[model samples]
Each structure stands twice: as C-alpha cells, then as structure tokens.
Target: MGDCTAQCLHRRAPTEGGAIVEDFTIIHDEGILEVLWRPGIGIGPGELDVLANTITHFPRWHASPVLVHLNLVRHITPPARKMLVAYHHAGPIGLTGSDPVDRVLAAFIAQSRSRTRYFTESAEARAWLSLIGVTAGRPVPAPAR
Candidate 1:
C-alpha cells in the first residue's frame, strides 16, 4: 500500500460556559497514529472518550500502531486512568514523554498492556513501534514525505 498521511486537531469544551478547552492532534502516517496532547491540559474521562472515538474512526485503526506524545500533559484523572487501562487497541502502542510525571503515568498504562512501552524520546518510540510491527507480521513502511 502507498503511504498515507493525515493530521487532525480535536477541540472540546471541558466545562460549561466555554471556560476550559482541551485539544489534541492525531497524525496518521504510514501505518502508525501519533497523538499529540496539548500542554497543561487535564486529561479526564471526556478527553479519553474523544481519543477513543477518534481512533475508532481511523481507516486502519484496528491494525495501526500508535505513538502517544505525553510530555506536556498536566495530569490524568483517576477515571481517565482507569479508562485507559481498559482501552483496547489491536496493535502495539508506544508512549513518549520526558517528564517524571509523564513517565509515571505512561508506566501505569504500559504495564496494563502487553503491547505498550514508554520511551523518553519519540524517535525511540517510533523505532520500537516499527520493530513491533515487523515482528507482528505487519511491516510498517517508511514515510514518503
């Protein structure tokens, strides 16, 4: 299959009166999905729900690996953490973050899933995902652009 790339930004009002707005971007490249979470955003159940819906709507959601950027995330609510543990993605997941809190949160999620790993650098995470994809019988092609 030829290379395909798509990027979308999602915004949602976290509370009434349009006070707080949380946004995230999802980039689909090759056979992987990269989720870029906005800085200082508090991740709650609503945010996770939006993420779930966005992934479900992707064309290759079931088979595509995911690279999650969590370096800037402020915190994750308890409910959101629980939801993430239960969330199921068919392919491997690579989480990249540098902050201690980010690593801790990622560790929690990664520990609950066999195909998930945390990385301090995004390049490493992508490399891991590529390796996982190849070993899983799905060779991830390099980006065309």
Candidate 2:
C-alpha cells in the first residue's frame, strides 16, 4: 500500500537480525509479504520479533497473505519453534519449497488457529493468496545469493 508494487519498491534496509534477517529477504506488494529464506539458519527470538514487526508495519499486513519460501531452510531452532507457537497469529499463510524441515515447521505452527497451505511451486502459492483476497503481485523473484 505504501511504495511497494509488483516490482516491490518498498525495501527495508538490511539489518542484523530481524524479520528480514541476514539469511532472508522480504518483499511486499499489494498486501502480500513474500519471505525468501536461506537454508540452515535457525530462526529465534530476534527473527520472530522481526516478523511481528513487519506484519504490523502496515495496517493491511494483519489481513494480508504471507508467502513463505522455505525451499532452502533446513532447520528451525527449538526456541524459534516455541516462539512460532506463541506468536504466529497470521492466517491464510502459503508456504512453498520442498524443504522437509519447512514442511514440518509449517505443520507444527498451523496446529490451532493458523490457516496454512503448502506448495511445491511459487505460482500456486500466489494463486491461493489471490483467491484469499491477498493481492497477487508479480511472481516473487529468487533472492540474490
């Protein structure tokens, strides 16, 4: 809603550890926030805080769809899992990528109030998000290595 569009004009400056952590990149367009995470970095309190902050950044975020690209991530720290249990309040979340750890993590977090779906392709994720009224912006590009 701010400066972001299909091209993702709104960019957060790289910070140490936040929602857009060193191991991940975040893109926003319309109301959807696409999180592209690198494998092996363990998510923890700092990362969780960053996610909360990002989601609350714009008023639309709470109601928006979040597409998490966890194709690369291999691990989720215990603390991070706990934090997810306590803080993952978003709904209509779409998760993609073939990482087994990511699948497990998504299932664990979606146990109660979270509405989550998994996909092997990003296009399907976006389609689902669009169906849910979350703006389906351009296809999310892969984060630069």
Candidate 3:
C-alpha cells in the first residue's frame, strides 16, 4: 500500500441512546478511501446521512475511489438502502462483502451505477479500485505483497 492515513468518524448511532460511537473508519491511501463499518451494526438513514456528510467534507474526496466493506452488517433499513443507491461519488466505488445478503445488497447498488462492483474479498476490491483509479488518472498504488 502507498503512504496512507486513516480517520474514524465517531458519529452517534441513532439507536444507541445518544452515545457517541464509531460507525465507520475511513482510510485514505494514495487516491482511495477505504471505509470499514462496525460489524453487526444496523444501518439506517441517520447513519447514511452522517456518512455522506463525512465523505463530502473529506479532503480530496471528490478525486478518490471508494472501497466500502459491508460484511457482517446486521441490517440496512429500506430508507438507508435507497439513500445508498442515490449517493453520488465523483470516483468509482468498490464494495466488498462475504455474506449472501451482502452480495445481494451489493448487486442492487452496483446495478444503479456504472462504476461500481461487488467483491467477496477486500483485496480484490482494492485491486479493482486501484485499476479504476489508474484508468481515471488518479494512479492509486497497488498493495504490497
């Protein structure tokens, strides 16, 4: 991996009695933003809103490919799913998940975008993102072996 820095946006969960929690971690490496979500957490419109805001304010975000890890998500509300499908990123997006439900969800989101793909492995997803970045003139570095 290229020189990278990671940031965690500890946004409050809507159902956690107003406790501040880390809903997701965003890693910036080369020209990629890798988002790792909390396992077994339920995602709703509130969570998606926070995510959208965080990404929108991130530095150079418009030029970075995104890799979202969706494995082990307990559930995603219907409204959240709709928001995700409509969320726009200037660069390509790569979604990685293992469960069957994850695959189905990824397929649904990918179908709505020309620059999205689903992968069972994160490494594969990262590779795809790097390729897309290169083709798009972002030039993300390949992961080190």
Candidate 4:
C-alpha cells in the first residue's frame, strides 16, 4: 500500500460479497496498464489487505494519483480511513451514502481534500479525478496543490 516499483493490472472483477475474490496483477499481461477493482459494497481489513497487496504491485497508481470510486461502498472504519490517508494518493475518492462516513471519515475527507492537495467530489467523482490528473487510459501521478 505504501510504495513499490511496478505497474498494476486487473481484469474485470466478479464478486460474491462476504469477501472479494478478484484477480489483481501488475505489468503481467500485454498492456495491462491500469487495474481497477470494484469490490463489494463494504470494506474490511481482509479486503483492504487484498487491495493493498494488489496495488503494491503497481507502485505507479498505488502511490500515484488514482481515482477510487466508492460510490457503491459507504461504511468505513478508522483504520481504513487511516490507510487511505497514509497509503493511497487519490484524486477524488468517490463517497456516497445516507450518513455512513461517520465523524472520523468526514474529517479525513475534509482534511484530505483541504490539506493533502487532494479532491473530494460530492457530485462527480470520476470527473474530479480527471480534472485533477487521472485520464481514461493512463496512470496519473500525484497531483500538486
């Protein structure tokens, strides 16, 4: 989740819920460019570890400016928030729910948006990501303030 020296790759994911059973790779196949894992609608350490390990392979996007769409997932834990805070460098981490982000995540959202030179789009997550730096077919680097 921190840093590595490879490019990440992933195929279309198929999931069943309790845990994510998605294939995550980095620079393995031909033009494996970028990997995007749309896990289930919730997150746990189990899933996070899988995600962390998967991205570690693609140091480019793992530590670079990435667009993580969380429009389908809402619930979050403090540890998860911390991991997002410390490890991932996202453009606009898509967030949507009825009030699930809680106090801690809200603060991290605010801080990551305000302090870390990141974007938190309430309207268009992917659009914001693209606005910052992410493109449809390229791995984006960290965005500056």
Report the C-alpha lDDT of model 1 over 43-138, residue by residue, as the tens digit.
Answer: 899888788777776777876889998888899998888888887677899999987898899977875554899999888999888878666745
Q: Using lDDT as the measure, which candidate wins?
A: 1
- Residue lDDT tens for model 2, 1-145: 3433454323243555545524555677655778766556566667667767655665567767888877677677778777766654444788887767667877766663667788989999988887775333435557899
lDDT of 4 by residue, 14-106 (tens): 566655444433332221223333433455556667776665565354324344434345555677666655653543344333234433344
Q: What is the TM-score of each candidate against the true structure?
A: 0.80, 0.69, 0.79, 0.44
lDDT of all predictions: 0.79, 0.67, 0.76, 0.44
Superposed Cα deviation of residue 49, candidate 4 (Å): 2.1
Off by over 4 Å in 1: 1-5, 12-22, 137-145
Top-TM-score structure, candidate number: 1
TM-score of 3: 0.79
- Candidate 3 residue spans exceeding 4 A from truth: 1-8, 12-19, 137-145
RMSD of 4: 9.2
